[model samples]
Each structure stands twice: as C-alpha cells, then as structure tokens.
Target: MNEETIKNIEDEKFRRLTGVKRSPFEKMLDILREAARLKKAKGGGKNTLILEDRLLRALEYIREYPYLFPYKSKRWGQ
Candidate 1:
C-alpha cells in the first residue's frame, strides 16, 4: 500500500481507539508521541503492574466523579 493508504489505516485505528474522529494534525501527533513516551517509561525499569494499578485507581476516581477542581471553582472557572 502507499503512504496515504497506510496513514488512512492508522488514522482509522487511532479514531477507533480514541472515539474522536479528527483529521491528522500536530496536536494528535503530540498525543501519540506522549503515549509512546509513557509506554516506554513504564516498560523500562519500572514496576509496570503497580503503575497500572495507580492509573486504574485514578481513572476510577475520575469516572465516579469529576475530580481536582474545587467546588467553588466549578461555578467560576469558566
């Protein structure tokens, strides 16, 4: 396949995983780069399971309720 076909496939895969159908741009590229960096960091000389557990805990908290921002700021932050 040509480069354009390969990119279309990759973009489709990324969209399926992220649920965001966006055209390829620098921001998306940066995000993919960050993902690779984190993956490599977790894989190299790190306790991967514990890192993943911590990530899951953070995810659970955010999923159950919005986090971080103080209650007062929610009304005014916008």
Candidate 2:
C-alpha cells in the first residue's frame, strides 16, 4: 500500500491489516530507510520498490505465510 492509503487507515484497522501498530510500523520504516540510505551510500543498485513498499511486502509475507522463505515464494518475483 502507499503512504496515503496507510494514512487513511484507522489505527486499529492498520494493526489488524499489518499486525503491528502505527508507532512500531513507523519505527520499522525508519530502520529500513536508514539501511536503504547506507546501501545507497555503498553503491548498491537501485531498488524498484520504495522503502515503504518493501516494508509492507515483508510484513504481508510474514503475516500471510510465516513458514515460507520470502525469496522462495512465487509472489516474490512480482
């Protein structure tokens, strides 16, 4: 989901959808953003997905299929 979609969601609904409260989600996003910045500084290749999208995808994967490796999943290619 995009930032606007996330912004319109109520706190409880967001928690239900992503399995984490808004505060923690933002905190996680901050960590991911820092990592992305560092990777960029190291000359890492650009990612197609933005940081928020990447974090959302990871959260969805964990919540929907906890046992599967993200890279091994068919949806990962998307």
Candidate 3:
C-alpha cells in the first residue's frame, strides 16, 4: 500500500488501543527487562552486548533528563 494508506492504518490501530500511553521511564524499564531476558536466554555475543549498551545509554538519558518524559505525569496536563 501507499505511505498515506499505511499511515492511516497505523493511526487507526493506535486509536483502537484502550490504555494510557507509557511513560519514558516505563518504556526504559521495559527495555531493560527485555535486555535482561536476552542476557539470560543466550550466551554472550557482540549483538547482545551492543543491545545492552544501547539500553543502558537510553536508561541513563532518561535518568539525566527526566523532563524529556512529560507524559510520565498526568498532573503536567499530559
């Protein structure tokens, strides 16, 4: 399908979801959890190491700049 059609489909799918959006911290937590799962599931590898590094950087970024996640608090009018 064309780009517009694809975008509309994705928008529709997103609108149909029933829950509030995840905060940046929550998202980072999920990433860390996934990284931990991957670490436990297999032996060490270059790809796994790279992914873990990326996840760590993401967590650090959110920690260092919490304002980046305004959606984290409903009181902020998010």
> Cα lDDT for residue 29, model 2?
92
Whole-model lDDT, candidate 3? Answer: 0.50
Model 1 regions lying over 4 Å from their true place:
1-49, 67-78
| C-alpha RMSD for every candidate | 9.2, 6.4, 13.1
Full candidate order by TM-score, most accurate first:
2, 3, 1
Worst 10 residues of 3 by lDDT: 14-23
List TM-scores for all candidates, in order.
0.27, 0.79, 0.30
Residues 10-43 of candidate 3: C-alpha lDDT, one tens digit per residue: 4445233312222443465577778778886886
Candidate 3, which segments miss by more than 4 Å at Cα? 1-49, 71-78
Model 2: how far is 60 from its true place, Å?
0.9
Tell me the deviation in Å of residue 46 in model 1. Answer: 11
Instruction: Return the number of clashes found in candidate 1.
Output: 0
Q: Return whichever of 1 and 2 wins on lDDT.
A: 2
Q: Model 1: how far is 47 from its true place, Å?
A: 8.7
Q: 8-72 in candidate 2: lDDT tens per residue?
A: 99999988888899999999999888888888888967788878888888888788986676566
Q: Name the weakest run of 10 consecutive residues (lDDT summed) in model 1.
A: 48-57
Better of 1 and 3 by TM-score: 3
